[model samples]
Target: MRIKICGLTQLEDAQIAVKAGADALGFVFYPPSPRAITPEQAAKIIQQLPPFVMMVGLFVDPKPEWVTEVLKQVPLDLLQFHGDEPEAFCQSFGRPYIKALRMKPDFDPEQAAAGWPSARGFLLDAYTPGIPGGTGEVFDWQRFPASESPSWILAGGLTPTNVAQAIRITQPYAVDVSGGVESSRGIKCPTKIHAFIKAARS
Candidate 1:
């Protein structure tokens, strides 16, 4: 029942999520995402965080040099690959990373899990054109291959209203959310954050 609130831009919202007992905070580095935050900005937010709170950096198909440069600036606790990055590419950075799988109707989670052995976990999210993640859409929760996969993070369209049910069904290692608790595209709602976490933990 770990809670990760993604797409945090404002320090207040980030702090609020932390106060609300979020296990992790995700900062999108992918420019195309509305929730995207620059490395410098992300650093400012990260610097003020309390200990034991995980800071995750979300990246797409970034070049090796760019990823290295970003790490030099921001002390990210974990890396989340939300695009088409090979296992070698993700592992080359020498950091723990979570691989995101854009689940389609016919996607095989077992096969996807085999491709990313080094990953700390696998995040299952909805697939939509022109958006890497945070589509605020839910797929068939019952379709995930949890029996075969060791680690899985359920994402997409999860909120306080249905998160408990989702957790009951998926029993994921963690839950990564962005748009589900948003006030807008990237703005998080503190009330929503509290409710979501409470539901998950209950």
Candidate 2:
């Protein structure tokens, strides 16, 4: 399964995630998030990372101008829309993107996905009141959509301890984590990173 390590803050943490075999590294751009980093900070980290590691930029309901500004500074390989961004707005940036869908009560994955028809994939995350994502709470894996037509990226509250089981149950195209591998908020633990990747791919 492909692995995406999110909420990256420091360069060392990013390198360890890459070295530990992460396929993609996610940089948070929303200001309200504690893990948020400036485009310049993300650029410096991206510059040091070797090619072939997909760099993802995470955004909330951001103004088009803000995205343009970020694109100018960081060479992001993917954009993740983690809030209530419409399909037109998402497509307007002219970059590949994935839409985050919180698995709230009665959530219809297929119906929601129909909105972003051209999305690269869909990230299914746990739902918490007033929180967009990164809540570190796992939703019921059984809630995973029955149809596999669209690529589904399983995220939220995944750690080394349960990742293998999650993959076995949900059979997702990819898995994403943030707090699960962190030594603390915005800080990743090398051991956790290695262990999580190993567990997911095992």
Candidate 3:
């Protein structure tokens, strides 16, 4: 299973995550998020990351100019849209992006993903009243769609202790963790990061 360590802020933490067998590193661009990092900061961290490690940028309902500006500065391998962004708008960037869905009782994964056909994958996260993502709460794992396509990324409330169980149940193409391995709002814990990845893989 692929592991994506998200909400990364410090360079040391990024390095630690990468070394601990992370497949991708996510940098939040949404200002409202406590885990958000500036383009300059992300750029510096990205430059130092070793080759083959994917760099992801997380955005929410951003303006075209802002996304353009971020792309020019930060060399992101993927774009994660965690809010209400239309397919046309998402495709206009000419980069690979994944659409994040906030899980509700009646939300349809394939039906909602149908619009963004260009999306590289779909990330299923927990729904909160005002939160776009990173709520640190797990939804019903049984809600995972029974699709043959290898494009589902499971997220929300995954930790070292429970990631193995989550993966065993969902069998997602990849797994994304933000707060599960975090020591604080934005800071990642190396011990947690290492433990999480090890557990997920096992």
Candidate 4:
């Protein structure tokens, strides 16, 4: 399974995750989030990264101008939209993007997946009222459809403890984690990162 360690704020943490076998590193750009980092800060971290690791920037419903400014400063490999952004808006950035679908009670994974034709993939995250993402709560894995289309990712509340079970059940194209491997909010623990990757790979 592909592993993406999200909410990375420190260069050391990013390096640790990369060393731990993470395929992608996510950096939050939403101002309200505690894990938010400036484009300049992200640029500094991205500069030191070794080859082949994908760098992802997470945005909520941001103005196009903001995204343009950030892209100018930080060379992000991909964009992940976590809010209610239209496909047109997502594609306007001229970059491959993933749309995050908050798993509400009535959420239909197949239907939602069909909606984003241009999306590289969809990230299925648990729905918490008033929270856009990073709730760190798992949704019903059984709710995922038996036949996957438009490749989907499993996120929210995953950790080394239950990731194996999650993989077995959902069989997602990728798995994403933020608080699961964290030492604290916005801080990643090296040991947790290593353990989480090892568990997911197994």
Candidate 5:
């Protein structure tokens, strides 16, 4: 399973994730999110990163024009939409983007996949009011349809302690984590990052 550590706020955290063998590093661009970082700030941190480390920029309900503006300033390998963006809206950027599904009691995995055909993958996260992600809440793993899942990233309240189990049960293409590896909101803990990656790979 691939590991993506999201909600990164510091350069050190980004480096730690990279050193810990993370496949991707996520940077939040949504203002309301506690982990949000500016393009200039992200650029500075990104400059320190070596080659082949994928960088993902997370947005929530952003204007198409503004999304382009941010992209121009920061070097991002992928885009992740965490709000009510339609398939056309996400594909309009001409970039591979992942759409987040706030997993609810009634969420249908097949229907969700059909709704966003253009997405490179789907990120399943727990539903929470006020906050789009980084809620540190896990959804019902049983709700995920075994035969209907697309290229997907399994998320939601996953920690170093439970990431291996999550990967074992879901067998997702990748696993995205934020608050689960944090010392606090928006702050990543290296120990957790190392442990999470080690557990997932084992």
Candidate 6:
């Protein structure tokens, strides 16, 4: 499974994730998140990254102007929207994007995935009333559909300890983790990063 290590704030952490075999690295742009980083900060980190590593920017209900401005500054490979953004708004930027779905009790993964026909993929995150993502809590793995058509990414809470089971159960196209491999908020632990990647791939 493809692995994306999200919520990176430091150059060191970014490098560690890359070295540990992460396919993508995420930068949170929403100011409300403790893991958030400015576009400029993200740009600096992106510059030092080796080629072939996808850089993803996470935005939550951002103004179009803000997205435009960030794109001008950071050469992001993809955009991930974690808020209530309409299809038109997400497509306006002409970038391949992923939509995050907050899983609730009444949620249907396949039905939700069908709604975003234009999205590159769907990121399923656990729903916490006020939180957009990174709740560090795993949702019901059985809720994931067995068939993989549009490509689904498993997110929310995932750590080295249980990522293997999660991957086996969900069989997602990719898996995203933030706090799961963290030393603290916004800080990644290299040991955990390596372990998690190894577990997922194994």
State TM-scores per candidate: 0.97, 0.99, 0.98, 0.98, 0.96, 0.98
Give the number of the best model, judged by lDDT.
Answer: 2
TM accuracy, model 2: 0.99
Tens-place lDDT digits, model 1, residues 7-71: 99999999999999999999998888899999999999989989999999999999888889899
Over 4 Å off, model 4: none
Candidate 2, residue 134: how far the Cα is off, in Å = 0.5
TM-score of 5: 0.96
Mark the regions of model 5 whose C-alpha exceeds 4 Å error after superposition: none
Give the clashing residue pairs of candidate 2, or none: none
User: How would you encode candidate 3's per-residue C-alpha lDDT over 89-141 as one tens digit per residue?
Assistant: 99999999999999988988878988888889999999997899898999999
lDDT, each prediction? 0.90, 0.95, 0.94, 0.93, 0.89, 0.94
Clashes of each: 0, 0, 0, 0, 0, 0
Q: Candidate 2's residue-wise lDDT over 1-202, tens digit each?
A: 8999999999999999988999999999999998999999999999999889999999999999999999999999899999999999999988999999999999988888999998999999999989999989999999898678799999989999999999999999999999999989999999999999999999
lDDT of 4 at 124: 91
Relative to the true structure, candidate 4 reaches a TM of: 0.98
Residue 114 accuracy (lDDT) in model 6: 70
Relative to the true structure, candidate 4 has a C-alpha RMSD (angstroms) of 0.7
* Candidate 5 positional error at 57, Å: 0.5
Model 6 lDDT, residue 4, Cα: 98
The residue-level lDDT of candidate 1 at 60 comes to 93
Which RMSD does model 5 reach against the true structure? 1.2
Which runs in model 1 stand beyond 4 Å of their true positions? Answer: none
Residues 57-133, model 6: lDDT tens digits: 99999999999999999999999999999888999999999999989998997887776789999999999998899
List the candidate 3 regions with Cα displacement exceeding 4 Å.
none
The lowest-lDDT stretch of 10 consecutive residues in candidate 6 is: 108-117
